[model samples]
Target: MKLNLKQADTEIQPQWQPIVGYPCPPEFEPSTWVKLWQQPNPYSHDEALLLCQLTEDEWVAWIPDQGETVLYRYQFFQR
Candidate 1:
């Protein structure tokens, strides 16, 4: 099913900071579960908001630090 970010179903918490890195291409999507880097060249990490809005085979997420949204596949992520 398709989901939109403007809807109440997608809520991001204030404590969740944006992950570090530029908006990576879909091909560069993490090969495994990746931690949300709190700082560039991170020595530590923080909880990231995995705001998923499904669109058939793809998913949408927000990156506040970059001020942009990214589309990726849910399967690319793991715990």
Candidate 2:
């Protein structure tokens, strides 16, 4: 997955960071299945569709758990 370095710099860094390497994974294409590596809870088809529709900023603002804990951009992935 490609990361937006500028966006990352603007946000407060999360304690749990991913360790990505060379030959980075392909970008996320719009799909019915998506997953967050850190979280086991699966998103339903409708929810996944909604997620695909959201912009990066909108996704960041939308807390999947609806709690104060913030989710970083890199945590998102296609299942």
**Tens-digit lDDT track of model 1 for 3-54:** 7757466666669555688664543232233334242223423322345545
lDDT of 2 at 68: 24
Q: Tell me how far candidate 1 lies from the true structure as C-alpha RMSD in angstroms.
A: 19.0
Q: Estimate each model's TM-score.
A: 0.27, 0.27
Displacement of the residue 45 alpha carbon in candidate 2, Å: 8.7
lDDT of 2 by residue, 1-79 (tens): 9876664456666696557675656655443344554552444221232234355433422334542223345655555
Per-residue lDDT of 27 in model 1: 35
Q: All candidates' lDDT scores?
A: 0.42, 0.43
* RMSD to true structure for each model, in Å: 19.0, 15.8
For every model shown, the clashing-pair count is 0, 0
* Residue 62 lDDT (model 2): 35
